[model samples]
Target: MASRTAPFSPFEFLIAWRYLRARRAEGGVSVMTWISLIGITLGVAALIATLAVRAGFRAEFVDTILGSNAHVTVYSAPMEVVEGSGVYSSLMRDYQVRAERVAAIPGVTRAAPLIRGQVMATKDGRSNVAEVYGISAADLQTIPRVANPETALGSIEQFGEGIAIGSGLARELGVGLGDKLKLISPEGAKTAFGTSPRVSAYTVTYIFTAGRWDIDRTRIYMPFAEAQSYFNREAGADEIEVMVEDPEHLEPLAVPLMRAGGDGTLLWSWQDSSSSFLRALDIEDNVMFVILSILVLIAAMNITSGLIMLVKNKGRDIGILRTMGLTEGSVMRVFFLCGAFTGVIGTIAGVTLGCLFAIYIDQVMSFVNWLNGGGVWDPSIRGIYELPAKLQGADVAKAVILSLGLSFVVTIFPARRAARLNPVEALRYE
Candidate 1:
C-alpha cells in the first residue's frame, strides 16, 4: 500500500478549511467556530490581565517599602541611666561614628541616625497621632520618594528650619505649607514634681506623599536637633537607619553589616517588618491564578461544544471522505487542524490585547477616572495612588499554554469520534 499521505498534509488542511468555512445551507460550523474563537480570546486576555495586575501590585508594594522606609534599622542596646545627670546613656550617643562605620562597609549606600517617636499633631483643634522621624536637612534629601522637587511640595532647603509633614496628615488637619501646627508629646520636661506633656507649635516647611497610604497619613519629618529636644533623646539618636545597594541580596553583606554596626547593636531587616504582608500577597496570587485558569478552561469548553456539533453535521461528508480512501488518521488530523487553528489565532489576539493593555494602563485608568467624574481610585482605599500593570513574558507564555493546551485537549474527543464513524452506518439514512 502506498504509504498513507502523512497526516496534516495539504489535502487535510484544505478539507479542514472547507469544513470550517461550511456554508449555511450545508450545516454551517462557521458560526460555532467564531463563537469558540471569541470565547478563547476573552479567556486568554482575562488571564493575562490578572497576571499583569498582580505583578504590578507586588512591584509597587516593594517600591513603596524600599523608597519610603529603611532596608535595615540598627538599634543600640543597654540604655543605661546616668545617675545624678538625669540622662540615659547608650551606644546610640555615638550615632554619628557608628553611622560612618556602617556607611563605610561594602554595599552600604547610606546610614543615617534618626530619632523616632509618636506625637499628636493638632491644627485648629483637629488632632491626629503622627509618627515622627527626626533627621537633618541633608539626610532628608537622601530619601528617594521625597527627593523629587516636583513631587515634593514646599522646599527641602528649609526642612531643618521647621518641620516636614505628610500630605495626608496635612489634609486631615486642614493645614497647608507655612501653616502652624502644634505637636504634643507625652515624654516632656521633668519638673521637680513630675513630667508634663510637652506642647509646641511648628511651621510646616515641606509636604510629601511617600507613595504609601499609611506613611503619608501619619509621617512627620523634623530636624534632628529639634527631634532630639522634643523626644528628650538629646544625648543621641534612637536608631540608625541603613540603606544597602542591593537589599534583595543582603546575605553576603549581613556579616559585614553586623560587624559595621558593632557589638551592642541589633539588626532588623525590611523582610522582618513586612513578612506577613508578603505571605498574604503570595497566597492571594496563587489563589487568583488557579481561579483564572478555571475560567480559561470554561472558555475552552466552548471549543469542544463547537467541534462536536461540527462533527455531527459533517457526518455524511466524513463518510464520503472515508470511502474516498482517506485514512482515519487523516480525518482526525483535519478536524484537529480546524480546532488548533481557531485556538492559535485566538491566543495571539489575546496576547496582543493584553500587552497593549498593560503598556497603556496609566492612560486607561486616567480615561476611566475621567468617565467616572473622579474619585474612582482613592489612594486611601487602594493604598497606592495609581493603578499599576506590569506585563511579564512568563505570564503571557502561561496564558498561551493554557489556552492552546485546553483547546487541543478538548478537540481530541470530537476528532476521534469523526475518525471512528463507519461510512456504511453514517450514509445509511442518505
Candidate 2:
C-alpha cells in the first residue's frame, strides 16, 4: 500500500467542499459563497476585457498610421538657394533616380515620390479642407487600406483618370462617384498683377477609408502627372516616402538609408515624428490597467469576509474535529481550500467570458450601433470608426496570477484565526 497522504490530502478538500455546499435555513453561508463567487468572476472578467480592448485599440491605431502613411520620409535639399530669405528649399528635384536607389536597400520595400499640399474641396455648396497626395497608379497600389477592394469603393486602375477622395470627405462634401468636385489651390501661377488662386474640377473616380477619421476626412489621391502639373512640381517631388519590411527596427537602417538617399538628405521615421502621440498612448494604457486592479482588490476583500463568516458558522464542527485529534494545520488547510476553490472556478469562468467578448467585439458593437439608431461611435472624436478588442496571453496570465495571489494571501489571516479558536469555548458557546 502507498504511504499515507499529507494532512491536506482528500480529507481537507472534502471538509472544505462540504462546508461550501452545505445548506442552512438561515441561508447565510450559501449567500456569502455566491456573493464571493460572483464578485471574483466579475472582477476578473472586467480586467481581462479592459486589457483586451486596450491591446486591440493600440494595434488598430498603429495599423492605420502605418497603412496610410510612409514609415520613413527622405527630404533632399534643392541646389537652388533663396537669396536674402536664409531658407533652402527641401525639394528632391532628382526624385526619380533617388527613389530607385532607396528602393534597392536591403530592408527597403517601396520608395515613392510624393507632392503633398492643402486645398479646399467644395461640392453642392459644402466645403471642407483637404490634403492632396500626388502618387502614381503603381504607387497607389502600395497603400494597404486604399488598395483593399473591400474598403475602397472605386477601382485603382481608374485612379489615374481623376482624384480619389476619402469616404468621410465624400460624405461631408455630398459628392459621389462620377461627380465633379472643385479643388481650390491657394498656390497658383504668379502673375504681373497678383497671385490668383487655381480652381479646378476633377471627377471622383474612387473613394476609400483609411480606417482613421482624420485620414478619411481629409486625404485625397491624385494621379502623379496631374498632381505634378497642379502643384507646379513638374521637376521634383516634395519628398520621397519610403516603406520598409520592418518599421519597428528602422534605427539599424539609418546609415544605409542616408547613404543611398544622397548627401544633405534628412530622414525622419514615423516614431520620431509621432513621439508625443505614442507617449500619451503609453500613459493611457498604464492608467487603465491601474484602474481595473482596484476591482480585483475588492474581490479579494469579499473572499476574506466570506471565509471569516464561514469559520464562525462552523465553530461546533471545528471543535468536534479538533477533539477527534485533527491538527490545527489541517483545519487551516480546509478553510484555505474554500477560498482557493472560489478563486480558481471564478477565474476560469471569467477567462472564458472575456475571451469570447474580445473575439466577437465587432458583432457586439454592430448590435449596439443598431440599437442606438446608427450613431453610437463618432470616429472623428475617438480616432477609429469601430471599437476593437484583442486578447493577449500575457494579459490573461497577469489577471490569473493577480486573482489567485490575492485569494491565497487574504485567506491566510482568516485561516489563522480559525486554527487559534479554543475548542472548549467553541463547544461551550454552541
Candidate 3:
C-alpha cells in the first residue's frame, strides 16, 4: 500500500527557516551571513547617531544665536552726529514711530530700541574689551538670563551709573557686585590731545551668565539713558531690536513689517546675519549623510555577496526541491526571505543601539572627559563643553528604510540566479 505523504504547510518558509538555523557542518548559513549582518548593523547605527548629533547641534546653535540677538534689527546708515543734529533728531523720532508700527505687526511680539558700542572694562588692573548694550528697563527684562532676578542687578531703576556685566567678564576683571569698574570708550569726548577716549567709573550692579561663553566673555549691559549720556549719542538708539512669534520664519515677517514702518528703513534678520555659517553647517550635514549612505551601500553589497555564496552552497538542495515539484518562484522566495531576514534583524538591532547612543551621548562624553583627567574642553579653547544629540523619528526611519531598501535591492540578483538554476545540471554531480 502506497501511503499518502502529508504536505508541509508553507514548505518554502519552513525550509528557509531550517536553512537559516543550519549548522556549518550541515551546509547551513555560513560566516558570510554573520559578516553581512554585522556590516549592516554597524552602518545603520553610525548613520542614525551621526544624523541625531547633527540635528541636536543645529537646534542648539539656532537657539543660542537667536537668544543672544534679536530676530530683526532696524537701523539707518551710520551718520556723523556733527553734520546735522536736526536731521539726527528727526531720524530718531521716525525710528521710534517705526518701532511702534513694527510692534503692531501681526506676528511681532516685542520691539525695543537698543544702542551697541565697544568699550574697555577695567578692574584691579585687568582690562578687557567688551560690547556695551544700552537697553531700557522693560527691554532688559525681555532677555532670558537678564530676566532672572537672581542673575541680574536689583532693577534697571537702580542701575543709575551702574552696569551689569557678564559672569565671564566679571571673573576676568576680578570685579563683583557693588565693585567699581572703569569703562573707556574710544568714541568718547574730543579733546586737545586728539579726542582722548572717554573714561568713566561705573558701579557693578549685577553679574549675569549669558549661558554662552562668547557672550559671557564680552558683554556689558547698562541703562539706555546712561549709555546715551556716556556714549554722547543722546540723539537716539542705534537700532531697534524686534522679537517675533516664530523666529524660524522671521525674514518674511520682518521684511514686510519693517517696510510698513516706512521707506529708507533698513532691516537685518537673524538669518541674514548668520547665513554663511548656517549654509556651511547645512552643507557639512548633507555631505556627512551622503558619506554615511555609501557605508550602507557597501554593507548591502556584502549582503549580495553573502547571498550569492549561500545560493551556490545550497544548489543541490534547490535542485532536489525543484525535482520534488517546488516551483521556481518558491525557490526565489526562499532566498529572498533569507536575505531580508538578515536585513530586518540587523536594522532593528542597529536602531536600538543608535537611539541609546544618541540619548546618552552627553553622559558618554562626560565619561571620556573623566578618563582623560577632566577638562577635555578647556574653557579658553571651547565655547561649548557639552556635546548635543537629538534623535528624530523621521531621521531614524530614513536610515532604516535606506539600509533595508538597499539590502533588499541587492538580494534580487542572487535570489533570481538561484531561481534560474537548472535542476538537471545542479543534481548531476550529486
Candidate 4:
C-alpha cells in the first residue's frame, strides 16, 4: 500500500512558491494586498534601523562620559574637607577603600583630592557662571582629561597658581592664555560692615574644550592648592577622586570607603549621581521600542487580513484538493506554509534593507549635507547632526525574531479559519 502522507521532497519550497504565484495570478493582487506586504517590510526595516541608531548613540555617549569622569567621587556630607589624624590610619585598615593612605590600595592607579563649586568667572567685564573644579596638578591624570592640556594637566603637576577655562566660557568672557580672570565665591566675607563675598583674581594659563557642550560651557579648572586657598578651606579638598583599573568595582569599594570615612564622608558612584540621566535613557529606549513595534504589529495585521482574503478566494481550490484526498491537517499546513513563506521572504527583505540602510546612514546624511551646501552640523533641530548606526548581530537577530514571530502568529488565526471550512460547503459555494 502507498503511504498516506505526502512524499517529502527538496522542492517543497518550490511547490509552496508556485502555490503562492498561482494564487496571486488567479486573484490578481489588489492595492490593499500590495499595501499589506509593503507595510510589513517597511515597518520591520525602520524599527531595526532606528534601534541600531539608538544603540550606537547610547554606547558612544555613555562611554565618552565614563572615559572623562571618575567612576566614583567621595565627599563630606556637610561639604567639609575632612582632616583628622589616625583617620588615614583607620581607613587604611580596610581593603576596599583606604583613606588618603593611597599607597595601601592595590588597584588604585592614581588618587587626587578635589574641590568643586560654582563660581562667577569674569574677564574683560564679561562674566558667566562656571563650575570650578579644583585638582592637584600632580594627580590630574587620575581624573578625566580637560580641554587645556597645559592648564588642568600641565600646571596640575606643577602646583601653579594658574587656572584653566572652558572653551565656551573662555569665548564668552574673551579670556585666553595669560589673561586675568576673577573668581567670586557665593559665600560672603564677615566684617564690621555688612558681610560680603570675596572675589579672588587669578591668571588663566590654559583653555580647554572637551567637546561636550555642558562641560565646555560651564567648567573651569584650578590647582587644588589654589582652590583651597580661594575657598578658605584649609582642611583639604571637598572630595577625593579615585581611579582604578576596574571601574565596575566601585560599588564594592563604596561600602569600604564609607566605613573608612567613619560616618564623616559620603561616597557617590557615577551611576548614583547620574541616576536621572540613566533613567531617562531607559525610559526613552523602552518607549522607542514599544512605539516602533506598533508599526510591525500593524503590518502583521495587514498580513492577517491579506491571508484571510487569499483563503476566501481559494475556497474552491481548497474544496478540489479535499476531494482529491487532502486531509484537513494537510490543507491547514498548506495555508500555514503559505503564510510562513510570506513571513520568511518579507523578513529577509526587511532585514536586508534595514542593515544596508543602517550601515550607510552616515553616508546618507553626509550626502544630504552636501546637497544643502556643507556647513557646521546643527544638532539642535536634528537632535543629532551625525547619523550613527551600530548594527549588532544580536540586535538584528532580536528584531528578525520579533518580526517573524509576529508574522507567524498572525498566520495562525487565518490558517485555522481556512482549515475549518466544510469541504461540501466550500464546493457548493462555487
Candidate 5:
C-alpha cells in the first residue's frame, strides 16, 4: 500500500535555479558577460517600447481617418442621368436605393451623398487654395462616427451662405466665427482679358481641428445648396460617402461598393487612396522590428555561450551523476531547465522595466522639455506631444513567445554537448 504524502511541489524547481545562479557567480563574469546581459535587457526593452508606440499611432490615426474621411468614397467619372428635373433632386430615388443597398452590405453602417470642389478662399487680403465639402447636415448625423460630429456644419436648413473652416485655415486667414470669407470658383474666374472667375463670400460659422494637416489646412464645409450655387451647376453632389461597421474588411468590400456605383462612377476605398502611404508605414514597422530583434538574438547567444562554458566546467560532475544512475534525459533536462530559468528571469525584468518606462514616457519628456527651456514638447512642432502608451496584451504575448523561443533555440547546442560527455574522459582530469 502506498503511503499518503503531498505531491511533488513545483517549488522544488527552485533548487536547480539557485544552483545555476551560484555557479554563474562562482566563475566570476567576464566583461563580455556583463555587456551581453546589458545588451539583452536593453534590446528587450526597446522592442516592447517600440511596439507600444507603433500600435498607439495606428489606433489614433485609424480613428482620425474614420472621423474625418468616409469609410468609402464613390465618385462619378462622367455625368449620369437621374430622376428629377436635373440629377440632384431627380436622382433622389436612385440615390436612396443605393444608400439603402450600401447599408445592407456587410459591415456597412451608413451612406450619404457628398459634393466636393476646389475653390479659392480669401479673407482680409489673404487668399489660399481650399477644398469644399457639400453635405446634408441631417444625414451627416447618422454617420457622425465617420467624421467628428462635433465639427459638423450648422443646420442644413440654415445653409444660407454659411461656411466652416479648419483650425489651420482659420489661423492662416485670421478669421473668426460670423466673419465672412470669399470663395472664388475656378470656372467663374477669367484672366484680365478673359472672363474673371465667379467670386462669392460666405460667413465663417464653424471651426474644426481634426489633426490632419492636409484636411485641416485646406478644407471648407458648407451646405449642399451653397456649394451648388457656387459651382453654378445646380446638379447633384459629386460623390457619396459610406460608413462601415468593420473597417478591417474594407479591402474585401471594395468590389461590391464599386459594382453599386454603376458604370460612370468610380468607387474608391480608403486603402486605395492611401495605399502608398500605408505601405511605407508597413515597411518602416517591419524594419524596426527586425533591427531590434537582432539585439535580443545576440543576447540569447550570450546565454548559450555561458551555458556551454558551464557544461565544460562541470563535466566531472555530469560524469558522476551518470555513474550514479541518473538517466541521460534527466541530465539534459537539468541544464535545459537551468537555461530556461535564466531566460524567465531576464524576460520578467525586461518587461517590467519596459512597461514602467513607457507608462511614464510623457512625464519624462515633459521633464526633459522643462529642463531644456520650456517648449521642447510642443505638438505644433512634434506633431504629437502627448506620450501615449497602449499596453496591448497581444504585444506582451508576442514578446514573451519570441524571448522564450530564442532562449530554447540557443540552449539546444549546450544541451546536446552536455549529453555527449564521456565518464572516463571527464573523470581523467578530476
Candidate 6:
C-alpha cells in the first residue's frame, strides 16, 4: 500500500500550523496555550516598563542636581590669613587667575568665580538658614536654568547690594521681590567684647525657581563684589565654578583642571559630590530588575507546561505518522515549531504594549496625581513632583530577547520527550 503520511518537506510545519489553528473539537490548541501566551506577554511588558521608569528617574535626579550646581569647582585649600589689623581670617583668596586657566581647559565651556557662605535669613521674625552664592550676572547665566530671563526677577547686574532668592525660600520667609531681609554671617568684625556676628540687610532683587526643592528653599544669589565686601574677603572669590560641554565625562577634565589650577587648588566634580546618592539609585535599579525577572521566569515555566500537555494530546497522531515513516526528528520539529510560534507571538505583543505604556506613563501619572488631589508627590516634600519614564530601544530589545530566549530553551525537554515516544505504545489503544 502507498504511504498514508505526507512528505516531511513542508508537512511538519504545515501540521504544526494546522494544529495551532484547529478548534477544540479538532484536537487543536487547549486552554493552557492561551494561558501561557498571556503570561509571557505580561512578564515582558512589566519588565520593559519598570526598567524605563527607573532609568528616567535616575536621569531626572542627575539633571536637577547638575542644574543647581557646577559640573566642577576649583578652589584654593583652606588658609589662615592674618590681616594687617592682626585679625585672623580663614579664606580661599584670589581665584581669578585659576578661573581663567580652568576656562581654557579643553572641555571647559564657562568658568566664573563665586563666593559661597551660610547665613541666617530673617524676615517677619522668622529665621531660616540659607546658603549664599555670589556670582556675576553673566556667569550666573551659564549655571543652568537660571540663565533664562524669565526665571529671575531681573538681570544679575541689577542686584547691587540686593540678592536673588529661590522661589521656595521666598515663600518660606514670607518675602517677595524688593523686600528687605536681614542676613547674619558668623564671620564678624573683632570687637573688644568678643567677636560679633556681622548683620547686614539686603533687598531681594530677584526670585528664581530651579525646579529642585533643595535649591529653591535654601539658596540665595548675590553679586560677587557685594558678597566679597559682606564676607570681608577683599582678596577675591572663594571658588571658581566651571561648566563643561559634557557633564558625564567630567573625569577626563579633572587632570587638566588640576594642572591648570596649580598648587593648593582642589578640583571637585559633581560625581564626587553625589557619589553616595548615585550609588543608591544604581542599587535600586538592580534590585528592581532582579525582582521583575522572576515574572518572566514563571512565564517560561508556563511555556514548558503548555508544551508538555501539547505533546500528550498529539501522541496518537504522532504514532500514526511514525507508522507511516515519519522520522522522530521531524516529529520533534513539529512540536518545537508550535511552542516557538506561541513564544514569538507573545513576545511581540508584549513589546508593543510595553513601549506604549512607557511612552504614556507621564500622562498616566498626572491623571493619578489628579485623582489623589495632587498630593502624590508634593514638590515641597519631594524635589520632583512628577514620575519620569524614558523608553530606550536597547532596554526593549533586551526584554524581548530574554523572553523569547527563555521560551525557546524551555521547549527542548518537552520536544525531546515527544521525539522519544514509542509508536506502538502511543497507537496501542487507538
List clash counts for every candidate, in order.
0, 0, 0, 8, 11, 0
Give the candidate number with the greatest TM-score. 2
Better of 1 and 4 by TM-score: 1
lDDT of 2 at 105: 94
lDDT per residue, candidate 3, 1-430, as tens digits? 0123233237666777777775857453567778778888999999999999989877876776677678888777544446756444323545578788889888888888888899988877899999999988778778765665324434545655578888889889898888999999988887787767889998988777656677788998888888887887786778888888898886568567757557556788889978898899899999999999999899878878878888888899999988987777778888888888888888888898899999999888889998998888565554543668999999999999999999889888898999999999999989
Ranking by TM-score: 2, 1, 3, 6, 5, 4
lDDT tens digits, residue span 233-259, model 2 = 878798888999999889998998899
Where does candidate 5 have its weakest 10-residue lDDT segment? 1-10
lDDT of each: 0.86, 0.87, 0.80, 0.69, 0.69, 0.81
For residue 167, give model 1's deviation from the true position in Å: 1.2
lDDT of 6 by residue, 214-283 (tens): 8888998888888887777677777888888999888788789888887776878889988998899899
Worst 10 residues of 4 by lDDT: 87-96
Please state every model's RMSD to the true fold in angstroms.
Answer: 2.6, 2.4, 4.0, 5.5, 5.4, 3.5
lDDT of 2: 0.87
Better of 1 and 5 by TM-score: 1
Per-residue lDDT value at 382 in model 1:
72
State the lDDT of candidate 4 residue by residue for 8-79, as single tens digits. Answer: 333334544566774446564344456666777888798889888878776655554565566667666542
TM-score of 1: 0.92
Model 5: residue 133 alpha-carbon error in angstroms: 0.7
Off by over 4 Å in 4: 1-12, 22-33, 79-99, 102-109, 145-161, 176-179, 186-205, 244-249, 361-389, 422-430
Which of candidates 2 and 5 reaches a greater lDDT? 2
lDDT of candidate 4 vs native? 0.69
TM-score head-to-head 2 vs 3, winner: 2
lDDT of 1 by residue, 1-430 (tens): 2155876789888988887786867554677788888878888888898899889988998888888889999886665467566665553888888899999998888999999999999988899999999998888899888766226688889887799988889999999989999999999999998999999999999998888888888999999999999999987898998998988776787788778777777888898898898899899988988988898788777778878888898899999999888888988998888888889888898888888888898898899989999889888877888889988989999999988998899899999999999999999999
